[model samples]
Target chain A: MDQALPELNNPPKTRRGARTVRKLLDAAQEEFGSKGFHEASVAGITSAAGTAQGTFYIYFASKEELFRTLVFDLGRRLRDFLTENVDETTDRLTAEAQGMEAFIRFVRLYPDLYRIVLEAQFVDPEAFRLYFQDFGAAYRARCEAAATRGEIRVQDADAESWALMGISLFLGLRYGIWEAERDPGPVVASVMDMIANGLKPRPGEGGTA
Target chain B: MDQALPELNNPPKTRRGARTVRKLLDAAQEEFGSKGFHEASVAGITSAAGTAQGTFYIYFASKEELFRTLVFDLGRRLRDFLTENVDETTDRLTAEAQGMEAFIRFVRLYPDLYRIVLEAQFVDPEAFRLYFQDFGAAYRARCEAAATRGEIRVQDADAESWALMGISLFLGLRYGIWEAERDPGPVVASVMDMIANGLKPRPGEGGTA
Candidate 1:
């Protein structure tokens, strides 16, 4: 799979080479995030990175390759961030709430996260699919472990993971990007409430506003 | 607002003109859906409609204009489909379940729905925002109504709406588009269970498999 993906086949062997690659990826994110994939150019990314035009080619074969690499890099970074923030020992519901809050904060810092991922659907369908699939797989594993430990109710981890992912993604889009003014505390609490107690009115509990 | 959108400013005055516009929009869907916005051509849309190239300009000013129009049109059509399919009388939980099931079914039929909507986030940010905003607003209204009637627990409708939308959209992307081989019934039931009962095991209810 790495061989099939030319972008991943070439890896920086030295510290200096890795620094250059990191700079290029950061510049590519800003370039692609602002101007989009179609309007973004190799020259623009190179200039933004303050690297020689030839330096970019040494790291990436083409602009398409760079974009795909950047996408993969972003997903890995995001997963790392989520993993570090969410405690594996916590119950599934607690983990979900913390994970959601962390995701929203991440999106707030990287406002271009959604734009770049969404653009991948058109510019690089395979990357877009892989990004989500990889995230879903990790999420499903965690859910399954939690279920086995009786930290959460027994359920289909596959479906549950996808549904939970949808909740976080949409919430990030709405509160993290679109309406940045709204407090995420209430939003997270409300969602976690539904995730914990559900929307059903408990017996003998009046639905009071 | 319609007047503000140049693409939507021009209205077909006669029944024949309206029919022609509809035909062009339908053809544009196929063209844009298959070829994407940048690669999709005016000639291809017209040809697909079985109409002369000049006739396209009568309805749309340019290919960009037509693409924007098509994105807006698809949103409206999808909103209409969800509205007509989701029974308003049902409680919020039931409505959510039915709506998710219907949306998945809709995507199965119109597999391009996610691609087009996701693409609009990059190609046309305003259209993409409006598409979600419009749906979120309507969803919030229903949620607010359900809360008032004591059918569901009281919560922040705005936040709830976005979360619910995220669930449906992501599920549609996962089950409807990527893993079409899987039955959506199980997916819908799993998600609905989460929404209704949540992940927390009830008191005295052993976490039985």
Candidate 2:
């Protein structure tokens, strides 16, 4: 309980107040997700939360603050979600396959996640940069750890981290956001094939070589 | 000049007029790149181009139209840039390495390119969608051709194209935009190594296995 949460920099003092803040966030997500940050109003958020407008001001100063807060909050939520979704298997390649598929599924579930994040570039470029920077930093650490444990090959884990994140991101943009309307199972499998085995055609693996 | 160009859908009739259009576009790039779409003004663009305010209306209907056009125009330029930079080498790996390094360099040179493209998502979602969609389709065709020619492995070229694009994109973001203050040579080299050899540790590689 004593642990400081940056997402909630202005911590709610009471347990009931914490719950109210949670309610506001949930309502804010849907509101901004549907209406976007520019069109989304604090009044709309409070209304959605079933709280009075004054109550909204009690916790936050303006809509801008809430949107930025929601970005970090969503970022944390996504990190936790992916960690939970990835298989517990020791093999990094296998985990990547599960992790990417799970990421796409997350985008589908949280349709507004991309919209909100993308809009952050326009609203607050710093927040947008930090979002990816934090994610990339954490991911790089994991890749390095996995490389040490021999779960993955020895490689430039920093570039690999960004590269892998890029793969998941574009796939999410295509399949999850664009409503690709195609089965991701084969798509993910194909990506895993490239990730697990290099793109160079092997002699016995259906290659003319 | 007879051939139609979508970015300049409203083509200037004479060579002189065409030059003016080019000037406006180039100036717009700097303007939007510096000011962003929302903050950017048509007057600012005209001022940058050294054209009269009335001349601005000769080609573009509004600032919005110019921004959209700039997005597509930039997309074309990037495609040309990457195509020109990728080596004539037959090996897919060689081409990829050359292509990725070139892509990163392009980002460094055209610092506003990513910002303009990202802003397109907010200004015109359809344009942003088409920008990547068109790129993915072209990239997929090339991947399939490379696979058929045995230049690369045969996998899901569709997913592979998106994955590759994602890699170049995020790398561009990290190295080009964020001012990493590090040479991209090593970053891109590491990615090339991963692309050439899978992440799995091999006997000869420095892995303890």
Candidate 3:
């Protein structure tokens, strides 16, 4: 994962170097998430990482660069996490349900993920755009493949992908972040019901008694 | 609208005062939108508003106060806009479609809305929470009402409202902000189809036939 990030000037070649980069990134998340882009400092990040200040300069060039890199890294980590959770499911709808659950779980573990990504829109708009654009493209491809295989309804793949993304994003914001005490089971079931049955009442189906 | 915002230290009493307050907010949107929170200044807003610097003090206490006020103001304006657009429709699904279209149009007019609200997540966490919380509560109520009237399928109103909100929010981000040139007709159609029909293929339905 350390080598995958192009923002690092010196890609970690050794296991020890990779560990240092990971530490720095983790610490940067805390600093940036808490203090935001303007107030966050390299010294704060280095102290949080428990590494010497000089070690920070070994990888990232500046605070802005580090932020941009972190945005990409978070997006990659999230995608990897979702893929790992959902890839085994053969059905698209089932995979989507699993992916949605995985997303909320990931957000629970990394509450800072939303803060960093939302901050990217201000600190680095291009990075923010790329983050969603990259995700949207990949999501569209999956939807297209699923439609081709008769796993889901055939529709406009791009629009469907964005709609699905929006559903997950808002659900994560509401259930995963805002109301942490609420069990996500009911929330996930409600959303999946909509995904499978939509909001329109079927011709023969009656309202709940 | 002026009286609705509690963030203002002194609400405008007269038509002229209300207009002045409106000018300040409009200018504040431009300043904050272009330069963000920290870099934005009272002088900048006043200059943009074509009003004296002292006039800003009459309505707002500080830059932070103005920002918090702006966040609430944007949310209210958006809700009002959606309400006005959606009220005439008799069917819930039709109302939803119209509301989604109005939202995109609103975002196009106020491109800075997303920026300001997203910034509130960092600037004033409480205000940010209130903004979405208020919207979610109202949306859930409407969905519940519609469900009771048999205007839509029976489901969890809170979850359904959030999912619908998510669809509109993401679609607004994609078609409204990112790719402004794209015609929203097709995009809205695609989403309404998804809302009207689930992603699952029916028993006798053919794929894209």
Candidate 4:
């Protein structure tokens, strides 16, 4: 999360410069998350970042560009974070729970993730599409590989990927953002139980246990 | 979808007045859907409805109120549509599939359903909150009843409700909105396959089928 803005179009030459850009991005997140994209101001972001208003020009052209960059940055960093958590060695079901737990953890750490990401849909539709498209592709690839490896079964990896992504998303909204105080362990277990075995009744398992 | 504005605050007394109100509401949907809430105007709505701008005030006071009314109107209509499709006597799994199909059908019919509902988050936060809260409550109740009736097994009905809702939401976005030309039959079947029997490898069944 503390990483510098290496992906910036105008790369920061000095370490101090990179730090300033990072500060502005972080401040922009808070501003945008709180006031939304239309209402958020560059001056507000700069002031929040503890930098002069002119300093924002050194990093972003306008509030919109800064928002686009922030949206992509969140997507990239979250992908990296989830990828690091669910290693290849774990079984698919285990990885599913682990991935969900990791996602919930990230959502908790970045309390504004939901608002910011959802706002991108209206602010920058392309970025919003790419965010989900990239995630869907990676998720589909994982599902396909798991199917190939005998770790899971699915009718369509593509559709299955969307379903799994939706589950993680809404669960993150509920257990992570809305009820951030709740322990994620039970939520993760319940979801994994449904994904691994489904809601179908098991033999001799009958009514409410 | 062509139902009259019986829920309007100032319900029209005459048949012609009812027609005018319904026209304004439908026109508001298109305007708000295309131009969004802020950019959308009462002028545009009245013009689209082929009525005088003064006619707008005859029913609703402001654009924000119209948007709010539209949001709740869509939700109520959609809920009614789904209720009509998924009857009380069906098995839980069958009902799940039926409900999803009904939802997809509704999404296709009201292509702006996603944008208007989503925009409510930014325009009318309270409305957005109530929309999901009410939907989540109904979904959770259904899950609890299903679990109690031995129609399904779930670790947590509340969490399961959110996950299932997410699946319906994203699937509607994909198959219903984005790929409107494609048949929803396959999407519904595949999702039901996943929900009814999860991704776990079945007994005597392994990799890639």
Candidate 5:
């Protein structure tokens, strides 16, 4: 979490500076969300922010760094939501549905930011790689713990981690983003149910369903 | 599937034009793979091909057109691979594995083109929407046939189609390209197994390896 950059200097001494920083970040979210890392220009962010060119450089070192900040902010929010939404009292199916709901909300709220982050996998993979590993590690730890408690099978912790993350992502990317118009709730429910209790037939229950 | 683009007009007097086109596509594959769609320029592709800028324009109208050509080429290959690999003799497991194999091989073969197609999802969604839809339709049709034959349970057809595609994509993006040095065969097999038979426990089988 430690960084070399000056950390906002604790709540911007001037109201104007605070407004400028907020504007720049908001502009950055839109620019980076739409244009991605390389195509998004410094001028684009500054112009959208309604700030001078010099003012833009004062807050962030480069467009890449600014985009990183925006993406990291979004990632942190998703992680926070995931952590806070954990319901220890519920069964696996119910808990998973809640988790899906939380994730769907996050995706719907920031579709552009979500695309930016997802697209970063192809754009500047190194940035996302470092961040993904850190984020994936935390997610894996939670899933492994749940498995340890006999909630799920402790089969290949890392593989399970990948699958869980992959499933959640695919469902979101395909239905939530690609379709855009389709309501993601029912699809989310179907996927979560599939993950919790898989597609295979159960004893005494025919495979009709 | 018909298009209005010029194709082999007046027939090539010599292999010279064919050779030039091949070099251009190869150059595009490299440039688009490494830098992605928006970041990759016409100059870059042409320069890589050792041809002039004018020649590049002669073959493709714009970068989007060039990208669509690449996607169509890859899609055709993937479609062929899927069809050739899956037959009545192939069970659910083999078919899934072959599909995964085809996906991994395609990524390895055209890493840059792969990035371009993926990056297009964020960079130019409208321009490339139909390309993805066409490919998705092809894949869904295959999955649908497999389901109707009672090979697998008829789950959400759309979700299953997209999930399989997304899993292959995110896995290749995350593991195939990003990871330092990973043999994707085993991981791909694990995912195929997961997809063919979901993660629920069988009645008689225990967690012991």
Candidate 6:
């Protein structure tokens, strides 16, 4: 956090400054969501937030910086939501059910932010690359820990984590938000069932649970 | 397909016209891949293709139209690549392995067009939606047919097709295209295995071999 940076002169410790920051973030979210990263402007965000252009600059450096912050904030919320809502049980079926439920809730709650993050992946490849790399690495570590405890048999924990993440993102996009014309729950369940069962391999290669 | 005002007034049956069109398509692929749909301009593409700007519009209605053609062209090629390269077998595991292998090879070969399509989904939502709707519906029908023949058990074939599409796209982006590179083959195999086995609900749930 840039604590030393002041609003023109000194650090903005006043109530007005804090309010301004919140409004800017709220505004940025709307602009970025609706207009996209390349098309969005600082002026548009500031106007939406009901602040002057100068005030916008005083709080954030540029449109890119603000959008980056917005992505970071949204990513945090998604991670937290997934972690908090799902039960910590190691059972695959229970975990799948709870995980899918929480993810569905999150997708329904913040559809635009979800789209923004996904769009950002294409609109701004550099940023998307950085975020996913960090996300994948962090996620892989957690999955590896679980696999170590025999919670899951991950032939390659990193690859499994990436695939699981792929399942989460694509299922959410195709059903929940992308078209906004379909119910995603049933589909979510089917895929979840697939994940729960393990895609059928050779006969007699099945696991005993 | 539309021949009313062939961009190349001269018949592409002529070797020169064929060469020009090929050059233009190649140029559009390069520019669109690097700059995306919105950023790349007609002039840039034409310049890259070593053709005049008027000639660019002469062959295509606009940059978007050219990009659309490129997408259609590339997508068809990808489909062809998948079918041709993936050696089919009666068994599920062999089919999956071959499919993943072909997919990995395709990504490595045409990363540019791959990113363009992926980015188009985000950059131009309406265009992608309209374009993919029919494509998705057709793909869903194929899956449904496969399920009917007892090749796979799918509750919602459309959703499963979409899920598979999503999985493949994300896997390509994360493993092959995105930064901090990792080999895509092993990752693809691992995920495909998980999709085939890890997600199955129970014995006999997937259907008898």
What DockQ does each listed candidate score? Answer: 0.67, 0.55, 0.66, 0.72, 0.36, 0.35
lDDT of 3 by residue, A1-209 (tens): 34354357678788887888888888888888878888999999998888998888888888888999899889988977887778644878888888888888887878787779977888898999999889999988877777777777756878878999999888888777888778887788888888877888777765432
lDDT of 5 by residue, A19-123 (tens): 788787778778887766777898988999889999877777777667766666667767777778858466444666677667766777778778778766765
Candidate 1 pairs with clashing backbones: none
lDDT of each: 0.81, 0.81, 0.82, 0.85, 0.66, 0.67
Clash counts per candidate, in order, are 0, 0, 0, 0, 1, 15
lDDT for residue B172 in candidate 4, whole number 0-100: 83
What C-alpha lDDT, on a 0 to 100 scale, does residue B150 get in candidate 5?
A: 57
lDDT (10s digit) by residue, model 2, range A38-89: 6788888888888899888878888888888989987877878888998755
Question: What tens-digit string does per-residue lDDT give for candidate 4 at B1-209?
Answer: 36846376777788888889889989999998887776788888999999998878877888988888999988888888888989768888999999988888888888786789988888888888788889999988888899899999888888888899989888887788778888887878887888888778888997565
TM-score per candidate: 0.92, 0.91, 0.93, 0.92, 0.84, 0.83
Which candidate comes out best when scored by lDDT? 4
Which has the greatest TM-score?
3
iRMSD, model 2, in Å: 2.7
lDDT of 5 by residue, B1-209 (tens): 22112243332345676677767777887888776776789999999999999887777778877777776666666666667755636755467667776666666665666676766676567645766678778767766676555555535666666666666766766665666267767776666555555554445554321
Highest DockQ against the true fold, candidate = 4
Candidate 6, A1-209: lDDT as tens digits: 22222222233578778767767777777788777777888888888888899887776777777777777777777777878877766555567567766776687778868867877766666767777777889877766665555555555667777777776776676555664565656777777656655434234332211
* Stronger candidate by TM-score (2 vs 5): 2
Candidate 4 lDDT by residue in tens digits, A1-209: 37746376676788788889998888988999888887889988889899997778877778888999998889888988888988768888898899999998898888676679987878888889888999999888888898999999988788878988988887887778878999999988887888888778999997454
Q: Which stretches of model 6 miss by more than 4 angstroms?
A: A1-12, A90-92, A179-182, A201-209, B1-15, B130-142, B145-151, B179-183, B199-209
> Fraction of native contacts in model 6?
0.41
**Residue-wise C-alpha lDDT for candidate 1, range A35-138, written one tens digit per residue:** 99889999999999989999888878999988888788778768778889989677788888999999998888888766788688888989999999899998
Local lDDT at B155 for model 1 = 70
